[model samples]
Target: MFCRILRRPGVLLNQASARSLNRAIFTRSYPFLHGGPSIDKKTAQKITVNWLYHDGKTRPVSAYVGQTLLQVAHAHKIELEGACEGVCACSTCHTIFTDPVYDSLPYPSEDEEDMLDLAYGLEPTSRLGCQVTLTEEMDGVEVRIPQATRNFYVDGHVPQPH
Candidate 1:
């Protein structure tokens, strides 16, 4: 009987209905699928910045609004060496972010990608700190500095605090 029904023309599976049903069922059945809380820029204030050093130290600080990651790091005296001064011309400021934050960011521009190709310890989540403009959604995110950068500086370059 099952084989006979499948052979009938109108009895075939309806892809459109099946897809809609699955979407509704899965979305409602799984709460995590709804994604976390929605973030609004107006309500998101006092972002807590995290700079994880190569030595396994976390130097947390407050970030100013409308500042890039590199700027925040520099302002806080973090060791991120933006050799090109946030121009995306060098990979000295390569930083790693968590998966969700990394995913939320827009794709890198051509210049940033060209520079990132030269970064050391590059991972899928690796990005140039200078190119990452801080947003409300990035609050409380950890920025992992790799062991080294392709630049001439050593693995741990300590620059003077501004």
Candidate 2:
């Protein structure tokens, strides 16, 4: 009966559901099925970020997939001055990537590039930390915060003390 059911068209069985069905059908039978490719176990990828502060302290952090670099920094209480609050209007959150993994990040938008132009100490790897999203491919990424951004302002107004 189980073989007949499995032989029918378009029958999909996930691991959990398959195990449940197997247990119900054959009470003392080992839950093992032949045929079909083995499922690959998923491995969580890690991203290593180094926050280089103006005071010469290097804080290392680990981030998982789908987290923005800014989010990671903020979670660790790292001082990355985002004067425009990550709206891409100010260059206060500017940072440079020291690792080759910088190239793995997506290209910046016109707005982010425009903001970076206003940032001091703009290097080839310069980017707005808020705009960089962490991916599995971005492992071991190193970023350095510039000293000039510690006191940045937006529209001539300073951000209030946090």
Model 1, 55-81: lDDT tens digits are 889988987555678777877877788
TM-score of each: 0.66, 0.61
lDDT of 2 by residue, 25-81 (tens): 565322124221222225546668888877888889977666666656766767777
What lDDT score is found at residue 8 in candidate 1? 59
Alpha-carbon lDDT, every model? 0.71, 0.66
The TM-score measured for candidate 2 stands at 0.61
**Quality of model 2 by C-alpha lDDT:** 0.66
Q: Which stretches in model 2 have alpha-carbon errors above 4 Å? A: 1-46, 150-162
Best-performing candidate as measured by TM-score: 1
Per-candidate clashes come to 0, 0
Which residue pairs does candidate 1 place in steric collision?
none
